[model samples]
Target chain A: MVIATETFRPLVLAQAKARKLEPHLIVVKHPVGGLNAEELKERIDAAFEGLKVEMKG
Target chain B: MRIVNPTYGIAPQGEGSATAGPVDWMNDPIVLFSNNKPNAKELLLGVRDRLSSIRRVDNVDYIAKGSASQPAPPEMLNEVVRKYRIALLALGD
Candidate 1:
C-alpha cells in the first residue's frame, strides 16, 4: 500500500498508472514535511486508520 | 469556443498490470519504506507504533532511500520485493 498526502496523491496515482498498477493508496493531509511531532500525529493517525480500513476490506 | 487544460498531458503507455498478492498483515513481513523525505520516516514509524496493537512489530521493518532528491536504486527495490510480503511506501512533500 502507498501512503501519500492529499497534495501528492495524484502523483502517486500517475506513477502507478504508468506502471499499470492500481495502487492501494492511503491519502493523508498535505504538507507532511516540516511539521512538529504534535502536528504530524494527525497524519499518523489518519494513516493508521486508512491501513486498518484496507486491512479489513 | 475551446479552452485548453494546462494540467492535461499525454501519459506513458503501460505494458501490463503489476499486482501484489494479499498480505497476511499479522504474519507476513511488511516493509515501511520511506522516500527519505523529512518526517516521512517518522510518519511511517508512528504508523508502525500504532500497528503493533494489531500485528507483530518484529516482522515490520524500516527501509529508506539514501536521499530524498535521488531515486531509489533498483537493488534496494529488488531487495524489498525479495524479502517483504508487503510494503507501505510513504511518498510526500
Candidate 2:
C-alpha cells in the first residue's frame, strides 16, 4: 500500500534536492535487525516494477 | 534544483552509542539521515519506494532507533558528509 503523504513528500524531496543527490538507491532496515546493507544496495539496482514482487514475496 | 523522494534505511542504536558504521552504496548517489523511535520499517520502506522512482536522487540514508532514542552521533553525521560530500541530514523525530 502506498503510504506517502503530501507533507512527507516535500520534506523528503526537499532533503534530496538540498543534497544535490539522485533518487535511486533505497535503503530498508528494521530498528532491531539494523540493515542488510548488501540486500538494500541490491534493491537500488532492481527495477521499480519488480520491487513489490521482490520485497513482498 | 529538483525535488526527489529517495529510499532510506532505519537501523537501531543504543543510548549514547555513536556511529552507524560505513554504508555500502549502490550504483548511485546516497544521502544518509537518521530516524529516531521504533516501528519505522514499513514507513521507511514506503518512503524509499516512492522516492526511488523519482528522477532526482540516487539514494537515501535512514538511521533507525529504539523505543528510547538519542540524537544521532555527531561523528556519524560528519562521516556521512565526509563520505557523500553532499547530504541533507534529518535528526530526531
Candidate 3:
C-alpha cells in the first residue's frame, strides 16, 4: 500500500494508473511537514488500522 | 552527509521501456524522500519506524534528495523497484 498526503493524492494516483496498478493506498492529512513527533505519530496511529486492513487484503 | 547540485531529470522509461509498471508494496518497498519538505527527515524516519513496528520488512531502503533543490533520480528508483518490486515515495508539504 502507498501512503501519501491528501494534497499529493492526484499525483500518486496518476502514477498508479499509468503503471496499471491497483494497489491499496492511504491518504494522510495534507501539509505533512513541521509536525511534532507526537502529532505525526497520532496521524500514523489513526491510520494504522486501515493500513493493516489494506495490507491484509 | 554528501550533497551534490545536479542537472538532471529522473523520468521513468516510456511504455516500451524494460522497467515500466506499478510495484506491489505488500511484499517490500524502498523509500524515497523530498528534501525540500519541512520536517521531511523526521517524517521519513517516523514512517519507517511505524511500518517496521506493524511488520518486518526486508530490503527496506531510502533515498533522500537533500533539500528539495535536488530532485530524486528516477533511473535509480526504477532500478530499485525492478530489483525490490516495491517503493514508498514520500511526498511533502
Candidate 4:
C-alpha cells in the first residue's frame, strides 16, 4: 500500500511510472504533519474501503 | 463502482493529467506510490499494514514521480497504467 499527500501526488504518480510499478495507494489529506497518529490512521484506513471496492472490479 | 473525493482537486490540468481509472486486481498487477515524504510514507505504510488484515495482497511496488526540477512524467504514468487493471490515486490538500 502507498499513501501520498495532494501536492505530492504528481510526483508519486510519475515515480510509479519511471519504474513501471503499480501498487495500491491510499491518498490521505495533505499536511498530514498536523494530524495525530490516530487521526492519520483513520484517514489511511478510510482509503482501504475504496481499494476493496476497486479490487472487486 | 467509482468513488471520488470532491474535496481535493479531482483532476490535474495543463501538462499534468492522465485518464486513470479503477481496476480489477484479481486479474492484474497493482502499484503504489511513494513521494519520498516521511509523513506520506507513514500514511501509505499505515494503509499497507491495514490491508494485510483484510485481504491477501501478494505484493506492492513503489515508484518515484518528481523532484525539484520536473513534474511527474506523463509518459511514465501512461506506460505504468497500460498493464494494470486499476491505479489508486489519493488526493488531499
Candidate 5:
C-alpha cells in the first residue's frame, strides 16, 4: 500500500495517536549492489526530507 | 538471540520444545526503515512465510516505503519505537 508523501506524516501521527503508540525511526543500510552508494544516499536524503517536512509541519 | 533469515536458511521448527528454545529475531515486530521505495508485498510475504513456519512469532509489523509514498518522518519513527515496543529493524536493499 503506497501512501502520498504529503499525507504520510499526518497519517502516521494519526495512526499512532489513535493507537496510543509512540513512533520510532529505524534507518536500514544494505550492502551496495544494484545502486551505487551515492544513489542510495540520495534516496535516503529524499526520505529524510519528507520526514523533516512532516516534523516541521 | 537466534536470528534466522528464512529467505536464505531452513525453517526452524513447527511446534513444541524446539520452538521454545530461543527467540526468533526475524519474527519479532519490526520497523523496516528504508531510504528508497521497496516491493512491500514481496518483502511482507517473505517475512510472513518465515514466521509462519515457526510457532514462536505471534506478530510482525513491517513499516516501509509504499508506492508514491514518502519515507517516515523522524517523529513517526520515534513514536513507533516508543509505542509498539519494536523489537527488530531490517534495512531494505
Candidate 6:
C-alpha cells in the first residue's frame, strides 16, 4: 500500500496502472514533506481512516 | 537475436514479485517503508503508533532508503518482502 499526498495520487495510480496492480492507496493532503508533528496529525488521521476501510474490506 | 540477462548476475531460479495468501493485518508482521524525505519517517511512524492501538506494533519495523531522489534498490525491497507480510510505504511529493 502507498500513502501518498493528494497531489501525487495520480502518479501512484499511473504507476499502478503500468504495473497492472490494484494498488491499496491512502491519499493524504499535499505537502507532507515539511509539516511539523502537530500539522502532520491530520494527514495521519486521514491515512488511518483510509487504512481502516481497506482493512475492513 | 541476442539475449540480455537483466537480473544483474543474480542467481535466477525465477524472478517475480512474491505472492502471499490472505493477510491477518492485526497479527502479521508489518513494515513501515520510508522514502526518507523530510517528514516521511515521521508520517510513517505516526501511522505505526496508531497501529499500536489495534494491533501489536512490536512486529512493526521501520526501514528507510538513504534518499528520496532514488528509489529503494531491489535487494532491500526483496528483503523487506521476505521478512514482512505487509509494507506501508510513504510517498512524498
| Candidate No. with top DockQ | 1
* Global fold similarity of model 6 (TM-score): 0.85
Give the per-residue lDDT of model 5 (tens digit) for A1-57. Answer: 112233254555575464455544323233322555454454344443433343243
lDDT of 1 by residue, B1-93 (tens): 899998897856656678776778789999999999999999999999999998899989999989898989999999999999989999969
Compared with the true structure, all predictions reach lDDT values of 0.92, 0.41, 0.62, 0.58, 0.42, 0.86
Q: What is the lDDT of residue A46 in candidate 3?
A: 43
- Chain B TM-score for each model? 0.82, 0.42, 0.53, 0.52, 0.42, 0.75
TM-score of chain A of each: 0.96, 0.31, 0.77, 0.59, 0.39, 0.93
Q: Please, what are the lDDT tens digits per residue for candidate 5 over residues B1-93?
A: 999787785445542321112333434454433344443333333444454554344555555543335666777677666645333332334
What C-alpha lDDT, on a 0 to 100 scale, does residue B71 get in candidate 6?
Answer: 82
Answer with 2 or 3, whichever has the higher DockQ: 3
Q: Model 5 captures what fraction of native contacts?
A: 0.05
Model 5 / residue B11 / CA error / Å: 44
Under CAPRI classification, how is model 1 graded?
A: high
Q: Tell me, by lDDT, which candidate is best.
A: 1
Candidates 1 and 2: which is better by lDDT? Answer: 1
Better of 2 and 5 by lDDT: 5
Q: Show model 5 residue runs off by greater than 4 Å.
A: A1-57, B1-28, B32-36, B56-58, B65-71, B85-92
lDDT of 2 by residue, A1-57 (tens): 111223354555565565554333222222222335555343333323333342343
Model 6, first chain, TM-score of 0.93
- Model 4 Cα shift for residue B40 (angstroms): 2.4
DockQ of 1: 0.80
Per-model TM-score, in order, reads 0.89, 0.33, 0.62, 0.51, 0.33, 0.85
lDDT digits (tens) for residues B11-63 of candidate 4:
43443434446444554565555444445556656656766786555655445
TM-score of 3: 0.62
lDDT, candidate 6, B27-87, per-residue tens: 9999899998888888888888888898888999999987789989999989998999888
Model 3, span A5-50: residue lDDT tens: 8887888778777676664676778766778877787656644555
Model 5, residue A53: C-alpha shift (Å): 38
Better-scoring candidate (lDDT), 5 or 6 = 6
The candidate, 3 or 6, that scores higher on lDDT is 6
